[model samples]
Target: MNYSRRHLLQGSLAAGGSLAAFGDQHLAEELERKLRGRRPLGIVFCVSDGMSQGVLSMSEAFSQQVRSQGTVWWNLMSSQKAVMGLMDTASSSSLVTDSAAASSAWSGGQRIPNGKINVDEQGREIESLGETLEKSHLRLGLVSSATITHATPAAFAATVPNRGQEESIAEQYLNRVDVLLGGGSRFFDPKVRKDHQNLFEIFEKQNYQVIRTRNELLHSKSEKLLGTFSPGYLPYELDRKHDEELMKKIPSLAEMTEAALSRFLSSGDPFLMQMEGARIDHAAHQNDIGAILHEQLAFDDAVAKVLTLTAHREDILVILTSDHGNANPGLNGTGSSYRETNRSFSKVAEITRSTENFLSQCQQELRHSKLDLAEFFTSTYGFAPSANELDALMERLSGREVVEWSQQHKNSVGLLGQIVGNVTGVGWTGICHTADPTQLTSTGPGANQFAGLIRNDSVRDRLLRLLPI
Candidate 1:
């Protein structure tokens, strides 16, 4: 049904609408044309934020260490069904696009500005692919390592003037989505919300299987699952790999993606699930090689999981792409030096883990009610400090640590010095997005339309045209 048909069906047509009322004839025509000969039961749009070319190459190489066969996504890229494109990730304001515009283009079929969701230049509202597909009577799923409100995932479901409108985005959960997972628990907490809308309670009341712990996530068999694994962004793969505690407590992206597919496939038809590896961008921003490589591997594992489940499904389409490029990650080769690093790195990945593994146990002691700051620090970061260090940390942390450190100049200097001491010179250009052409690869039926170096908007335009909701 078109806009007018929808309104007329509800017996309340809005003013200034030009669409004609829905007719059974038109409905039959749509079905015959799109759904008759073809059987695209579902689509999964997976986007990695700010993945540079070097990032992709290195990630594949990194995964090769795990299986020696290399990254599944890269191998799938060579298939005939796959289409290649250079996504011009420019937003309305710059050559480089932020997560909002880059993702909105894919989610809404319209190019928007940086930091805006489904809004146009004139501040008008636009329905995202998530909302559109929801209206089509299809189950909707959004999975990301970041909070669901983080720009890319929000681009398809929430319409807001600013990308930072996370609290309101959490309210959209009441739309009764089939499956939703990721971080950003602060937005759902009643005490954290200024408007007194405790979304966690709302979700619980809605009978959604709300899961906050890894064990809960592992055991959940509910029809609908809402998992917020962290208060903020989940730890990078580097952190998770290094930290044994985190690895066991928090499931990998692969597990989350596979769980979503299982829940979606149980619904008897194809569903829309978009999976994002959010922390890859954060790792790039921090210029942490260990973090970047591990996170990309996590994303690759998720991609591999999807392919394993959907590879034989003629009705399932998978579009994998990145929003923009960050830090232009590259391995400065000294001939075999790069190769040597990978060999050593693979061994290191097995032995070393993320810092978060050790920190999770510390969270209970660090909770607001307990408030043992010094002990918390001592246990988490391995810095059993004197009174002077404790005093400084108090001054820096203020009363509550709802917000994490920004990794800024002086802070970065001190923190890095304390944790992995005595570093200098290297710093993030800015805590912002960078402009660069991204990569897009698609597979499954009608995936040919996504080929041959297209624009970012073409990703959506093709999908909408090929499968207009």
Candidate 2:
């Protein structure tokens, strides 16, 4: 049955009115049964890329500290209405998985290599969920904080042997995806693209409203939209929050989520939309505690928006999960009997910028004039680094070898993270993807299919069952 706004509203009003008029218990029970039997008209899948168990816990704590409230995700897990599960995230080549294979497991229904998207180990092409949905005349939408052609989003709609082939992935989304909102404007701009192909013009010719600014996105009336806010991945939530001008130019993850989802909901189309908070993974890779927590919170805000928009509708299913774990950042016990734990964790709130922004400033300062590294660190992080820690950071930035046990932690960002972690009580297990199952939760119709420990490869089939073609 093709579910439309009229059909759904009429069914609901009729059932509700009849029950209210008759006031018979049997009539109410029959109405409930029929409502439960109806299939969903849409599905929204939210991804907090590279979020670990610790990230979720820290985000909850951070939200409580700043907003004086628990996070939406934490509340969802506490509630009885949502079904919770753990996703077994792995790849064909290794126990650890990158964004490409992890998402491919869900989109293509196969555990390919760590860096391939919808391509099997033998290089065979697998049909992606977006492609399959397109064939059924169902719409697909992708909203991400990463470049729109990044691994996680690309796995859903585009097939390529290597995840690095982003230009090709951008091309593939032309007709397959109905709503595309994120970063990576360079891939669409003819002047910046290597191929000099004007993707914006092409998409506009195909009836897509190409937008580049936050204002345009907010005012856009077109149902078919392609909005790119940055040349690459959008600025990290931590960085964007502190910059006044950048805040006006770029939309929040929640805003993008709303823009994509509202269009689908109003159109009354049976659709699949994927919303991603992509910066959490980048922050985790850098072992930046402040950035990671802020990114996770941004993702949580998007989750809250999703639940609110679908609250009254019984025809939308929402699933939230992470692709893989990275750096596994956790707050460690500090001081006698761990009494200092909260105070130590509180230091994260003082961080004014991401490590990436800090490093960029350091580079500019060092090149142009004398920069007191110690003073710079104190100003940005709200704490002065010790002489030895400052020396190590400077050496690492200069490409000098730092005697770090883990090869992944030998970089300048990792060194800075460790120095900051000393005060924040947070510790990271290197800077790379971990072999861990990710948290999963779902609500609305067919949510039970995600309960318990589910493998990533089973996601496509579960979604397909709910969305009959």
Candidate 3:
């Protein structure tokens, strides 16, 4: 990084002590001086769902250890090209918010109750940012590492009473979103839907080019595209990198972002696009440090791709943030020694699969030899437990015991998480969402409006103000 960039980041980090320390008057002065009378022709909002600041730090350390450079998100911070802020992610019903309500704040300019998407508690549907952009004749696209109809992306394009009504959300995307990419093939297939309606056929009837693999997505020429590479959520990045078949079938978050940008920009019309790294939340909920680290890295790479496309262009506005925090994971001192925490993350690269995937494989091997289970863990994670630890894990893996243990240990994915944490020194507070303020960063036109402390709903209002309509 350049000298000025380094100086700016150091100053920002010092000023960003905590959300409580950020005063409103300072923020008002900064916005007044920097954001007045600015307009952008297009907007790209990128979300790393459930990303806490601790996750970003862990990912940066891991990236520097393995890749010899920090992640692009940190690079943007160190380059002083991004404006940073903190967003309070609370729903109308509670201080802690789920993905649906958290993202609805950004999509609808208000915080609805948890589990509803762009629908108020009074049973009225609010206009989403996607609808507002479409009214101005700007193209809109939604991409995710999760199912396309999942809560985070669905909030932007669909209005539903409950997030579980994914089939209905899938139908709404047909006419509303120009570029819809990600998984959830089951929701669109006739055989899987309760009504037996083939949503993909309906999309094709309306002139959408459906893509099902990485190669197809790269080569498609359609202006309107619907790509589903997995039946459910895509595989974790660590697993995808290790598996040849998955790498061929599944598109990375960065690849989907690039493809959406290609199709949207081709129209030469002002566009609004939202891309999500939905699996980072999933990994955090599981307390799988390796999975979350790789997912964050993938999300960071996608952010880099967006910055590259909008480089030196004042007409485009890019916003990067997260819905809320999950698990509140962080690196903890093993023995009162905070130094060399990076060394613990270096072993994370040896972890080729998620805790859930590895445990499932071990369950399948129970039909054969129990020794196979121990060997698998030892070889894959480079950690062999003591006799007592192996005995406890074996008890959990037995017939009826396994089900009860799984229910109680959902966050750890059974004993796998504890075993992994014992090796990596990463820790988690719980398996659910926390009421932590998420970080927000912005650049390009109207970026200054996002500096300092802001509410989650303010993101929607600022972007809406920039629309041509």
lDDT of all predictions, in order shown?
Answer: 0.69, 0.90, 0.82
lDDT of 1 at 240: 72
Candidate 2 lDDT tens digits, 1-469: 2343334333444323443534455654564455547567899999999999999999899999988999999999999889999999999999999999989999999899988999998999999999999989999999999999999999999999999998899999998999999999988889988999999999999999999999999999998999999999999999999998989999999999999999999998799999999999999999999899999999999999999999999888899999999999999999999999999999899999899999989888888777789888998999998889988988877779888887778888888889999999999999999999999999988677678898999898777766645
lDDT per residue (tens digit) for residues 352-415 in model 3: 7887687788777876765465677787787787776666677776643433334535432535
For TM-score, the strongest prediction is 2
Arrange candidates by TM-score, highest first: which order?
2, 3, 1
Q: Which 10 residues in a row give candidate 1 its minimum summed lDDT?
A: 9-18
If both were scored by lDDT, which would come out higher, candidate 1 or candidate 2? 2
The candidates, ranked best first by lDDT, are: 2, 3, 1
Cα displacement (Å) at residue 432, model 3: 0.6
Model 1, 93-207: lDDT tens digits are: 6787888888888878778878898898999987787687677767788899998779988887888989999998888756636788888888888888778787887887787
lDDT of 3: 0.82
